[model samples]
Target: MKIVVAKTAGFCMGVRRAVDMVLDASNLSQEPIYTYGPLIHNPQVLEMLEEKKIFRIDTIPEKGSGIVLIRAHGVPPEDEKALKDAGFTVINATCPRVVRVQVIIRKYAQKGYSTLIIGDQKHPEVVGLLGYAKGNGHTITSMAQLLALPRFKAAVVVAQTTQDTAFYDEIKVWCKTHAPHYKIFDTICGSTEKRQSEIRRLARENDAVIVVGGKQSGNTKRLAQIASMAGKLVTHIEDASQIDYKTLSSARSVAITAGASTPNWIINDACSKIETNLQKLHPIKAALFLLRDFLLKTNIMAAAGAGFLTYACSVLQQTAQSFHHALIAMLYVLSMQIINNLFTIKSDKYNHPQRALFYKKNRTYLWVLAVISGGAGLYLSFITGMLSFVILLVMSLLGLSYNLKLVPIISKKGQIARIKDIPGSKTILITLAWGTVTCLLPAVANHSDLMPVAVIFLFAAGLVFARTAFFDILAIQGDRITGKETLPILLGEKKSFDIIKYALIFNIGIIFLTVFTDLLVKRAFFLAFIPFIMLLLISFFEKDNLISGAHKEFIIESSFLATGLIAAVI
Candidate 1:
């Protein structure tokens, strides 16, 4: 059987050193052997030790001068004292990289600098490092955590051996700005960095990447995350035996990488299984993958398009009271779909092939729906009056221009396809269009005053700009990858976050203005403001994950509903 192995495999320098120390002590000592933990994360290696009569004890077992092997993770200073006091022969197998972190913390602490460790606080390595420090130290998991710490006169920062380098740098910058004096020691292990860099290179070169390691291993999880960041589909596995044949069947090129502790033998076994299994894939499975990909993209586009349309309709209904006005408002929504489809053709072909396939298969059906919906809306506007029809026509043209010509200009310059790509472009065009056709167009057709319509536009403009900024921040990464110049990407993450912070402040200002003008009641709006504030707080903390996008959408939509309910009651 042929086998393929990753370049980086088996025990790393640190793990090898630790394991050798344990084995050497077991052979030389006359006492019964025991370890503080499994020694390393690999189950096979731990089982092999058990077969050789090695055992484990959480604390020094009562009764004899037995040998106790410290795990690669290392233990706190207090635990080391307890073992020494118990009269057991202590065999130290702690990884050198972890020990260096403890030394750095202690050195800084003794010099009167507050120590800060950036990683998961619950990890044994962090806990051990904390024990070496004399004074109260802080453990920061995210940028938001930095806000809760008191201003320190001087600080020393160190990272977990396997934490992402970029995240560490971000924390370092924050500390420098907030503390009087700050020192950063980059303690991430070289072996872990080499493995992660190799995985990133593999992900960029291949259609998909597979990372094999124990699920509970921190380094293994980091490897998978790094691959995903490079825009590759990554599947993390415990061993080669866990390879999902179905996932690999259609992959044209697959790159495989493994964590430091994974053995070469297991990697070879998995590659063999993948090659053999891929050769026998049925036609039905291929068809299913194609079908699933098409449905997923279409669903995403449809959902986004529908959300834009719904917001347009709601803004219109606030000032318009006639059925004819609502119908004209729907025409602008129809035009937006037609426009988005026209500009997305190339992107859908390259980055999203499945969506391109769907468009090819259903272009005629989609175009026909666009025509019917748009024509019906125009006819409703005509029935109300000639002026209403002209206004609806202009709004339709503006919506079409967003995707038809404007988006193409940005795309040629390699920018993300959004109207806001043009700096200082007011959403006033879209917002006014929505508010006029939906609210004022009908009111005019019914011969009513336009004061209510003017007030509605003012409120819609502020909300529209806020929503645009929120989305830009959320899509910053995708925009950067595609070479689109958006506010967030141009400003960087910290500055972008600051901009959003101010945008929220501006939104509150608008609410105050509305109250003074008596367009909206302060009491009713403030009632809904409670949830909005909660949502903003959640968004601040959840900025680092995909869940943040979902949370933001939920909060925005809920706020809209709550505000509408309050309006109805008033």
Candidate 2:
């Protein structure tokens, strides 16, 4: 079965902003952090926040302390003032779109205008908006409620940010005819319009549609309502576990979408589950998917890529007998990556669920594998030379201690025990380590000249740095939840991507320069495409709608294998 995910399926701008602000407050401060209400409509997010000790309070306390954030659904003017008066530092994390609607209401309410809102009467956003209406507000959910009201001498009409587009259009047309003097503003969020329209089109095209989001989410439910209006099979589920495969077994194609408040992890989990179940009918696609996911989860694909990269770098330096060094790189990478994964299960619970479960189930065997591969790497380096042996030994020990508590010091916030506790250490260390194993070790084995060795090391490190930073971007959501200060998290996603792009472009330029100057073999010119292709892939992610899951991860790891193929062919 063919599966398609809608581009606008996760975290519209406002919810993302609110969530980020709250999370940042939680991670960077030692004070108690609270939201005035649940951060968003998504239950999973609220649960995760709770786990992180970011609590929510419904009422303003008589004497509050620490910090409190306004939810994405903006609060009343009075509520905002009260929270501040209660001695709590308030951060308004309200969606700017919702704030726009509030501004429109407040502007007209001062002129004795009645505010007519086309949305659910009890919705939090509508309630917040009404707070700005100065007591002359009326919520009209249907044509009857809208027509029953007296045509006011002066009134302003607005729809809830998540109001149904078709319904709101009807409201506008009716109000324009009946109350010609009334001002009508397009208050429905642009995101809501796109999502509704897209779901309608997707529902019409696909055999079945699965809407993944909180059932109580207004926009999410409206999406289901729209899809169901198309007369197709539609399931509105909170997560993957709620899906009923027996109900959807006959469908040949499925369309997946999520609400604006929904996070990528939940949507991805749903997509993964559905794809896994549906792919069983196609043996070839199913087999390939299983194989790819296995390699990704086990870190085997990463290890193989390391081996291939080592071989390519060796050939670039004109080193003799590159296979053994490639093996050493592979073993070192396999052992290090496995150990890293084992220690990162907390973040993996939100980043890569399947891999977390796999690690837990095979903990003992994986430990055995890591120890053996690391030992084998040491043995190979020892056989090569004393310098190689010492370097590999030091690198391996550092890798092993990365997740271990060496400082044994506890602070007011928590223990800054492990090397991983140091912010932005992972990306830099991984790049340096990969470069050492792939290029520097081989140069040492053959006593290659410094200029070529240094240039080749830069080439290898540049690609590995891009790879690490790119994955960090993909896993930013989980990393934030787990309080990880990755390069992407510290620099922000856009800046990190900018850095990755510049790095890749630089690598490409270096490759061409070396090839043109005859400093490296002509086959090394093919290596330029590695970074080039990666740049294009990163561009796809920058589109801001692609799902970061197994498929993207598999393709990225395969880029390393491309290096091996290029080396072997020449």
Best by TM-score: 2
Q: After superposition, how far is residue 8 of candidate 1 from its true place, in Å?
A: 2.7
Please report, as a residue range, the 10-residue window in candidate 2 with the lowest summed lDDT.
406-415
Which candidate has the top score in lDDT?
Answer: 2
Off by over 4 Å in 2: 407-417, 544-548
> Would you estimate the TM-scores of all the predictions?
0.47, 0.96
Cα deviation of 365, candidate 1, in Å: 65
Which lDDT tens digits does candidate 2 get at residues 1-570? 888889889889898889889998987788999999888888878888998999999998899999999988898899999999999999999899999999999999999999999888889899899999999999999999988999899999999999999999998888778788999999999999999999999999999999988878989999999999999999999988888888898999999999998888788777877888778778888787778778888889999999999999998898987999999999999999999899888777776777888999999999999999999999999999999999998888778767886545354458467767778888998999999999999999999989888888998899899988988887787787778889998999999999999999999999889876767877788889989998998888778554536667777788889988888887
Give the Cα error of residue 441 in candidate 2, in Å.
1.1
lDDT per prediction?
Answer: 0.60, 0.88
Steric collisions counted per model: 2, 0
- RMSD of each candidate relative to the true structure: 21.4, 1.9
